[model samples]
Target: MSCSGFQPISLEKPTPEDEELSDKLMEKVRSVGGFDSEETKESKGAVLLKLDQIAKEFTELLSSAMSSTEQVSGECHIKILTSGLHGLGVPTNKPDIDVLFVGSRLVSRLRFFSLFYIMLRRKEGVKDTNAAPDAFVPVIRATVDNVEVDIVFAGFPSKDIIPGTLELRDDNILKGLDMESVRSLNWCRVNAEILHLVPEVDNFRNTLRAILVWAKRRGIYSSCLGFLGRMSYAILVAKICQLYPHALPSDLIKAFFELFSKWKWSWQCPVLLKPSTENWEFGDLAWDPRDNPKDRAHVMPIVYPIHPHINSTFNVTESSLQIMKKEFNEGFKVVSEVHNNEACWSKIFEEFKFFDEFQHFMVVTASAADDGRFRRWVGMVQSKIRNLVNFLEPRNCISSIRVNTEHFSPVSETNKYVRRWFVGLVSQRPLRAKDLRSPIDKFKSMTVLQARRVGFYTEDMKLEAAYVDRHQVEDMRKENSHFGAPTLSNTAAVGTGEQPSTSSVAEKTCQYDETTLPIPPKVRKTE
Candidate 1:
């Protein structure tokens, strides 16, 4: 199961063969859009550096503002909780900075956002700053120099002065805080906790980079759309490291898919490094399915290894969960093939058959007059597409509803930015017009209302819905030649909205799980 000479941190450096494999793996990832290229990484690092500087300046300004206020008795401090600084985040092209403002205990939550908003308005290069004090986790999301920055505020313990080295680990840090503050604190706390749990930093980072990109490409990565978020994926990878502390990136990557794909979800087991000791100490109840019915209802529970151990996959519903499971199974088989020399590593991250999979497709198109308007309009529609999926699941005739993560731009003279997402549909019985009408109408109404509620409704913005046959999809794909391969090479792999199960065929020829690695005691027994 394990590759030789690929020891954890003790190994001086990867051996020649190990290095070759690593380079090959990373290169394969890059080819299939599973990992960022070196150029992309370097560019992202530059942006992050600039973001770090901006965050520092913003913090200083906030501290000055708080100190000037009559309501503040003592000094207020602000710090940018950099994930890269702490080796917590995999290097990514996305510029999402989590900025924490530590203020005096006397300062109110409302005052924090209000003051931050004012400071943002005065600052040059800052735009789209919105302050929602009433939000469950009060945050000020804004763009500085076109990079997204998320700002959260937390106060010092009681009337105590802020320390130069403030660690959120102190039990008193979150004490007497409202739910929103506690939630906000978790952004930093959880990141810190995950970093602490991971044994091999390099192995964890590299393997996670592959998994994260793969998940995103597979379309099962969106947290906003009831799928695994970054934090949840981090927790899962960290747990794998706990089990195999010394495994290299290659071994860990194989083990990652193997372990999760075989995971017994019906048991309702939670993945944890160790039994959670975060109990009523912080006035929060740790997740225990036996006692909390809410915990029992989670379709897929990946418990965070921290206080109040919330299920990071709480947003997952039955439909999304199934989709994720099928994807995991596919990933497991593909990796198995690469290991057996039956296929290249690229096969593991190959694009799935989305539009061409089923006989009929639900084509939902959102068009806008400009790129800016289209981005906002499409984003709102994408976030709420899960609602449409959930609504379709209960109907008896529907086999599966698969959403295309990649949208297409259909031809339109008036529409400057036209993005269309296809929802592949498979029916248990013969397709009937009457059965499809009700769900389509319901989906249309929900999308339209959501667009209007989110202020995306305009004369320039439009929504189009239609059910197209396979021949129509082929014609559309032919029309758009710039898009990648229009069809999967293996026709057998294309069927039923669910990904075709290749593991059964892969198993006949390949011994993917030849190594009998011992499962950890904690992993075997439910807590």
Candidate 2:
């Protein structure tokens, strides 16, 4: 399907005045520092520094508190995830710092509870030690350079399958640390690749910026599962990438759908299904699956609801879902059209077949989604799309259309002939500009090279027509201003001197113009 709806709008090219504005914007960037430089840190700088300070202080305080506790054993290891240790390449006004604590067995559990309780406690002073519960672990709040900090702890299993000491070994925690770092690095690399591959960086950036804002507003920044969140999605993607480095995007999407389906019905507890209701018939309920299937179904199992914290972290409202649907539909349409067309696919593959490897990686990972069979089928289709992208990578042309005072005109006959010849040369074998012949041919042919540049001249005539139409409408409105004279058909209030307002005769004149506005085309639905 052709994008006929996207008729090129005739717009005037940037004039000298517009050039001045562009220059000013560029200058502002320079004055602040380059885009990638630290000088232009903006609000992100303050946030990062604050987070770093908070992490250090929190780590130290937790270590000191654990060391003092007689019940605790081993050391503590605290690692800050996200942009706290290394920036994720995006400018953030206030980015969350995810910290993971790997440490002693008993101490880790106690510290985790104590840290959470102390942070939530309403009292200012410490209570009697004897009155504290056996599980109570004291946590002292200390400022490290004035930045606020929060610490959470988790225990690592020892070789004997028992809980380890509070002092977490580097070897035990390395895998998780590496996983987070690798994911962050991959995210940066993927975005950079996108900028390199996509012609319209500004358009892409604008869409991403809008999505980011919407996600933040909805509190769905993380793709964590259980709740509708983005962090879980990201983590899933990262895990897939780790497993299948060459998986295609389509494979990942299909896998996600499959997982969603499986997660929907895997845990079928009636109580979980009905969270609002309470069951208080007995203090404790015993389950005998054979005799009491219904009761068994209501039993709460460990990890019954996977990643329960996700629900609290993300807020996926109806509006957010609608926005995502719109964007996804647009992208799906564009990609599908390019993939299904044999000619386009062949062109893309002719230049870049290696991209298929990436697709394969994505598909492989997606196949691992909860519903294996369904996910596998989805992965297969995604692989096909990736192959299509590879096929069209070369022939696709992108050019900026310009509208000037000059009327529409084709390139000179000689330039056209040269373009056809160059196209033939490149068509035989994919070649960059360095391999091409004739400097003049290459220079002049840029307008018609692989991408054709189409130009139109409607600035003068179109503006004049629009101005005339607008003025005519204004004049007609003025002439009719007094045509509709208002007279009181019924009067509820009248002054003593007012003649009963003449149950006045009123003439309401309505004007109709036979102007037809353009109707937008209907959007197509995906099967």
Q: Which stretches of candidate 2 lie over 4 Å from their true place?
A: 1-73, 76-79, 83-91, 112-151, 157-229, 232-323, 330-527
RMSD of 2: 30.4
Question: 1-527 in candidate 2: lDDT tens per residue?
Answer: 11111122222243464344334433433333223344334333453455445435444566565455445555544343321212223332222222333343333443433442333232233221110111111112222222222222334433212233222212223233222222222222223323343233442332232223322322223211011222223232332232222323333222222332233221132111112222222112212233444433321121111111011112222222333334334434433443344222112112112112111111111111122222222212221221222222233331110001001112333221110000011123333433222332333233122111111111111110011122333342343212211011101011000100111001000111112211111100100
- Clash pairs, model 1 backbone: none
lDDT of 2: 0.25
TM-score (all chains, Cα) for each model: 0.74, 0.27
Model 1 scores worst on lDDT over the 10 consecutive residues at 488-497
For 1-527, candidate 1 gives per-residue lDDT tens digits of: 22112123232344566556667887765565544446655654564566455545544554555455445555444444543212365645454344665665544565455444554645777775554344344556566766555566676547445566667655467777765667667766777777777888877877877787777666666554566766777777887777778766766777788777777663166776556664664332346676767668767777766666766665567877888878888888887777667887666666565655799777777787876556556655655566677777888988787776655776666554877777788888776666667777787787667556534466787776677778888887665424321111010111100111111111111111112312223221210
Task: Report the poorest 10 consecutive residues by lDDT, candidate 2.
Answer: 490-499
C-alpha lDDT score of every prediction, in listed order: 0.60, 0.25
* Stretches of model 1 off by over 4 angstroms after superposition: 1-20, 30-72, 83-87, 95-98, 106-108, 128-132, 157-161, 278-288, 365-380, 408-419, 430-433, 440-466, 471-527
